[model samples]
Target: MHTPAPTAPAHARPRAVHWLTTAAATAAVIAGAALLQPAAATASPDTAAAAQARPAPDAQAATYPLECRGGAPRVVNRATGDLDGDGHLETVAVVRCDAGIGTPPSGVYVLTSPHRVVATLLDPGDGENVTEIAVAEGAVAATLLGYSSDAVARCCPDRMQKVKWQWRNGKFTRSATPDARGV
Candidate 1:
């Protein structure tokens, strides 16, 4: 006679299946906890490694070249002084102011050569505007003040380039007044 294979009972089989399902659920929870961690909540092992991989915020550029379009540069005036603090004015920095007249555009620049900018500064303020620029002795002095335009005024002019370079006793200062009339 051939023997028959034994079979598991339905009731106990279901209980055993329940324990297996519980173990699988627990494993899933542990796996999810491992993956759901907040990165910045604690200083984990790789803090130094992270710092090495990022750039410092305070880093600056070492050198920059100067180039611009729409305006050419020239030295309109020159003075004698030690502007660069090297005891001589051989290193000349040029400055210029461009303005708008009805249909023309305006801008300003400080130049160290025919094509170099030692420093570029904004040329407008609360009660003043730079209209003319010249370099002397190594220093850049610009004419500034309120000026009258046909669009802004009518009678008595009431405007002029109010300041000039006062190179006194090897030192320079800006003097201002009024009456800067322009188009």
Candidate 2:
């Protein structure tokens, strides 16, 4: 017959459990604090300083690829963000012809540093007007307003679409958002 091992007194059991629980909680707190620390810097100090010193591309200085009938292209709305994951900011501008009365189609253009137009995300020839445009998380998003048919008036858009463009495979790919619908 095996002899039973001596157990701690009942009064000490609670204290033992409390000590274990406290130890576990202290360990958890240490691990969490370690995780909260900033990661090691991957970029050099000079590179980081240069990136911070350089401002994002200016929308007003870049020339758009829209052909307006005697009127110049004007930037209506613009947003700046890093669209290529290159740590440099780019400008996304929603531009349209400076029309006197009617609404003109808007073109979305991406501009890089030094105010150079790098890509045209949207062409004005598509006959769609961008009401809202934004750049975030290395992507460009816009709300386009368009006519359903020729009978629809230009001033009143019957079709509404939300689109996003992300840099992929050496080019920007467009995708429609799930909530995109006509108004």
Candidate 3:
């Protein structure tokens, strides 16, 4: 009875090995990216300067109303500026496209008083969803009106942007937007 069967020749083997390798490699790469996290937000020179330049968060409140709109409904840094004014500052919006008054599009969110923006009953206006939202610095008061039925693409920040972005190490970063001619 017998000798053990010999191993199959490479040519006789199933191509399934190649397919399995490709699938495994692809899955590994996807997993790596999904698990990747942004580097810790180190304070840049500008951040340091901004911190030094602005008044203490509490001190600037009475003078500027230093409202912030990000990272939950907490108070702002206190000494911050209009940030792009789109009425609210980036601090309050948490990111761009903040929904200051209602549950706006998903990207950015504008912060209101802890209790203010609670239940945005969709156009349930009557000041129910129309919370005291922020607007651009020079924007008209009428523009502060909130939407009711649905959010339209018209919600993109109305602030005129003069972004002067630069490609840094394969990424874009902006130093500032120069003053506009008439703006």
Candidate 4:
């Protein structure tokens, strides 16, 4: 006659059940985490086509409006983003007159495809230098260094201003950021 296998001891039974419960809970957690994970991104055909159709404007190839006093305007800093929600990238370039001595003020220009200057965000005539520039979420931000007065030396800027530009209503609007303060 066939005989049944021996079972776990009476006192050990609870421990075995607890171990199994813990394992099941751990498995359930793992499964839940897997379900909560974000799905991998896949580009749609239209997005791929749009990307191919429009590329970021070349900052180096564009001609700026700044009069360099017979010297060439140089691109000092550049950032790219779709500033106008046009589904195409635009280039924001910080340009300055190539000077040998003191700090020359910078002009911020926006360039569209084909390397055309479409907007001048910061004019060199404004007498401020761009210390930093960035583009994000269809907006351009910059830290400007300037003098407190005509008495201040050009080499030393005593004022610091943080500014931002966003495209709205067919034009770019300028706003001072919260962190603007004296340097």
lDDT values for all models: 0.42, 0.89, 0.34, 0.92
lDDT of 3 by residue, 43-124 (tens): 6456546545543223212222123357333332211233332233222221212345644322112222221221111121
Models sorted by lDDT, best on top: 4, 2, 1, 3
- Model 2 C-alpha lDDT versus the unseen true structure: 0.89
Deviation from native of the Cα of residue 70 in model 1, angstroms: 9.8
Q: Model 1 residue 173 lDDT?
A: 54
Backbone clashes for every candidate come to 11, 0, 15, 0
Q: Provide the TM-score for each candidate, comma-separated.
A: 0.29, 0.73, 0.21, 0.73
Q: Model 4, which residues run further than 4 Å from truth? A: 1-49
Residue pairs that clash (backbone atoms under 3 angstroms), model 2:
none
Q: Candidate 3: where are CA atoms >4 Å away?
A: 1-14, 51-53, 56-183
lDDT of 1 by residue, 105-177 (tens): 2223333322343433333222344456555544455654344544654223344564444445644454554
Give lDDT: candidate 1, residue 99.
23
